[model samples]
Target: MLRPAFLAMLLAGISPHVLAQPATETVPLLREIKNWVTGCDNLRNCHALSSPSGVDEEDYSSLTLHIFHQAGPEGYLRLRFDHRGEDLDLSTLLLDGQPLGQALTRDLHVELDDEGGDPEMHFYSVIEDAPARRWLQRLRNGQRLQLPGDDNAKVSLSGLSASLLLMDAVQGRVDNVTALARPGKAAASEVPARQPTPVLRKFPTAPALTAQEQAGLAAAAIKALTNTDTEMKPDAEAGALSADQAMMVVRTDCAAYNCEYEISSRERKPPYTETLLSIQPLPLDGAAFEGSVGYDETTGTLSYFYKLRGIGDCGAGGVWVFDGKAFQLREFKMMPRCTGSPYGDWPALWTTLPAP
Candidate 1:
């Protein structure tokens, strides 16, 4: 188990080296540079993304750039452009006011644009060998990179070098020739191997409860929620119980937009020994509960979705799978700022391996 202070540092995206922990045991990290936010998962796959709103821009722009670097000696680097405007002529793309030239060719870049009206277009390209080295040289010292013409947007390159340097450091690529920010003659073979991902195997599903068992469990949950001594009638809408009647998950309160729920497990029969199940607490508040939660019997998974706003653009969420005894974290993701991005776009702070 991670110490409280260490976990807090990881949650805040502080580099593990700041805490003097071994590199092999480094937790995932997320750090914000001047104009970019960078993060790396346990597997050492690093991602750096520029904000839609640049350092000097007041309004959010429609174009963004994303750079990805995989770990290990043979890992690859990729660059992607997401544009929410009209079709772009690749020939007009600019890197610090100069034409991108043939460095960005259609044969090397794949366009995945939507077909609808005012569709969002994505230009994705994998960079390796000579082109990767040359582009890295240009980008590390460049000022601004943009796509020219109407609906113009620029990603500030101010903090890009520092961001890439951090990525190289995290993956042990400091002086390696493959380093994005600080390349040297050191052989790529010296780079560390990618770490294996953690895995959590879900327990077998519990047997379904009978109608009577469900009703009894529901009543008990309501009584506990209301803090009443005697058994109380269950509200049809809020009555939710696990398949085996061993867990009760239901909403207890709500405000203008957010609703709070409680999760508790108990003994199967009378004089039930019920104990509330608490998920990992959020850094914002000391609370260890979720806004909305549910249980899927077939998969033995309990999931939660908490919305920071009514529109549900930003917030924290996670999934915990039952292991026949207790719940274990499977994944957790959060997007602290709202940028009109979907939940799927959020950076994952925690992740586990797939069941074989």
Candidate 2:
């Protein structure tokens, strides 16, 4: 039988089935997040708690956990632990609790960013990340990073990882530090499997407009969006739907924090065309990656894809077109880092593009 101490090792003692307060509004500091985290010795937030997530409190602190979900900064579903007599391990993110190495490594260098706060506060900004790789380079544009510190020009840099937190009103003499970490959001994004996508029952794609072929226009857009932290490429080639064949359709729309598109496009020469369906406003809170479709379309379906800020052309490759109405594991790939590739990392499952 699991003892209380055993349970405390996974979660912080909260019920995994219970939802903790999210960090949406500025949370009143029962304790500074940084301080509280670096000093968490109790299992209240460490282990034994159970929520609908089945994640124990102790699981939350096991820096080695590969499964971590955050409901934005407001809410988090993670498996981590505080540094108490143990070295903080944050090398990579925990993916389903399995540690991934160079094979899936996206970050190779943890370069420091710009200076953080005013000297009066003696605070500094540093990014706990790898050097500017292709994706990191694109994400770095106009972005700012800083260390969490107190208003008084002071910082106690001990017992902290590469995360953001508030430090004390004093400064530390440390410059750089390293720790062994395990391998590694917002709104709930549900990824659809190879099943048939949902059709509006009545809402088919809008008809194609424009008389001339627009390959040149798509080419132009591709040129313009390169490396600008905009535009995306599909991660992999989706199960192909012939040009305007049957009902294979692709379309998209978005809100802040995310730009989504419902895909159903086909293979055509010159410019590829896709139909535009439901365009939701950007940044639906609590919205993560989502994909689900249940229509009577014999064997065709649509995929839910997103365009994230700072992550241009850096995401999942394509959706898997599974057999037997059940979407199975289609292989996963990353989008090319160049321009003119399938925009965004995930590809449009529907091959039929909207008529321009």
**Which 10-residue span in candidate 2 carries the lowest summed lDDT?**
167-176
Residues 1-356 of candidate 2 have per-residue lDDT tens digits of 22233223223322212112222212111111221121111111111111111121211221111112211112222321111122222344232333434432334322222454222211111223222122223222312111112111111222122121111100010121211111111112221112222332222332332233334333433443324443455221223222232223211322453443323333233444443322221111112232222222333343333332333432222333323223332222222112112242121212212212
Best by lDDT: 1
What Cα-based lDDT does every candidate model obtain?
0.63, 0.24
What's each prediction's TM-score? Answer: 0.79, 0.21
lDDT of model 1, residue 173:
86
lDDT of 1 by residue, 156-265 (tens): 77678878888888788887888888788989999988777777765665666657665666677666775333233323222223443476775665555655565777
- TM match of model 2 to true structure: 0.21
Show model 1 residue runs off by greater than 4 Å: 1-11, 14-25, 52-55, 105-108, 111-123, 127-133, 226-245, 268-272, 275-287
